[model samples]
Target: MRVVKRINALVLTGLALWLIGTSIAGAAEVNVYSARHYPSDQAIYDQFSKDTGIKVNVVEGDVNGLSQRLQREGTASPADLFITVDAANLQRVKAKDLTQPIESATVNEVVPANLRDADNHWTTISLRARVIAYAIAKVKPDEIKAYEDLADAKWKGKVLARTSNHPYNVGLIASLIAANGPEKTEDWAKAVTGNMARKPQGGDVDQLAALAVGEGAVALTNTYYYARLKGSDKAEDRAIADKVGLIFPNQDGRGVHVNVSGVALTKGSPNKANAIKFIDYLLSPTAQEAMATKGTSEFPVRAGVPQPAGLPALSTLKVDPLPLTKLGELQADAVKLADRAGWR
Candidate 1:
């Protein structure tokens, strides 16, 4: 009877230890509400979990909507991080007081000074250039060498762009404002608006498609869209991609404007340390490599890692020196300019 009771006590102690261990592991999880819904991120997230024991819980939604949700939830919100594509989206969140400023030596060391927020509220993870996708048949590479040329009379009714309010277009216009004052950028806006092919319908990929169909001669697009089309399994996608040529406009001047995808910490995160750890992990070489090669096909922000495969070497193109944070700063002005110019 004594031996049996001793065995029973041992089982009870083991059960309690198992329950405590389970509780601790559950507490190690971090919740993220991200607008970055890229499918390639799944493997990266999985790898992070494998490398470190912390689990990631992700809820994907539009940045504006998700930020609003966090605002409503306030301190009660479960979100520890917000990952979004446009710098403008990060600004929106910061404006609403939904994100907290975080400092990490790893982040500052890995990301460029201009790519991360000055206050350390957010940091860019990857980059993509907004460039002119010209039709080889209609225009020679020499014919379209600058973004300013899009407004030239020679290309009137030949321009292809998404709606004036697309984050990509707005960011580009904002960069123009940073490079050339608002007066010049606004003038450029009015001229470019008059050059649109057909009321600016469809996404970047659609514009490339229109270029193939001869609807437009020059389509303004981000490079990755062209890359995907060029690499697509579908013959139709590859065929459209074939007729398209890219011009990294303003190379002799301000260089091509770029947009970035960024990550930030939630204001009242319950897991701030873990969140920072996750962000640090993302900025590490392993994560940067994966994000650059497999995810968006955009240039990685960190040094040493190469830009996406098949994309041009980062060394070859002159990057615009204007800090991307300016895009968010001047976004309101850009929108108003686009509106006044009747660039609907």
Candidate 2:
């Protein structure tokens, strides 16, 4: 009986030690659901782990798919953070109540107030400008100056754009609606649709390609896409970039329209503290430089980080001051207006 009692106590002690060890291992990791598809992001994660002794595990998917997954998982979700592009996408997730407000002073200080959520539910990690990429040889820069100019009768059949359903376009039109009421923005959309060089088709890169080949005189594209082409290793991509010149539209007015890729804390974040630490690390100058200057080619939200080469200075262009949260609020309206305007 004495021998049996001693064995039982030893067994309990071993089991308790194992359980504690397992919990410690699990507590040292953070799970992330990320929609930003940049390949260089892995290195950034690796660095975070090295610096802080916290492991980063990422699940990648499109914005909508991930948001749906979070909703399905509810409070049992393993995701501590959700990262995606575009204000509308972030807002969509927020609207679904999949994210909770991130109350971090470091995040607020590193990222500009305008680039963060008003309620701190989400914040921009990087910025991309939506600008007019014109065929240098075909269109003189002065002739096409503002986003509003695309709707002019003289530029009929000379505009190139992606489908209206694209989030980038939705954000653009939403900003326009914020700047000018829905009615006038709708009118602008209708006239711009009337000026299509061809039925809106392909992604921004394709639009840039079409412009390079003279399919259209001006193409609406993100600055990073142009930078990718300019900095591409392939000679053909370089040639395509060479054929195009960028115009930061509305510089004389509300400034160029800029969009963001952002991060938010999951409503049911299993590892909230670690997730907040990761968010702070991402906003750090070192991480910002890695993301912005590496393959991602995006402008860092933290002011002092250097932008990728060949992209124009962020300070030079006048940025549209409309709160990005408004982009999400007006997104549905923007899409409806585009459809009514025939911007297929």
The TM-score of candidate 1 is 0.93
What lDDT score goes with residue 32 in model 1?
A: 86
| Model 1 per-residue lDDT at 157 | 90
lDDT tens digits, residue span 177-238, model 2: 99989999999999999999899999999999998988889989999999999999999999
Q: What are the per-model C-alpha RMSD values against the true structure?
A: 2.4, 2.3
lDDT of 1 by residue, 108-208 (tens): 88888788787889999888899999998899999988888888988889998989888999999898888888889888888888988889788999999
- TM-scores, all candidates, are 0.93, 0.94
For residue 322, model 1's alpha carbon misses the true position, in angstroms, by: 1.2
lDDT scores in order:
0.87, 0.90
Q: What are the clash counts of all predictions, listed in order?
A: 0, 1
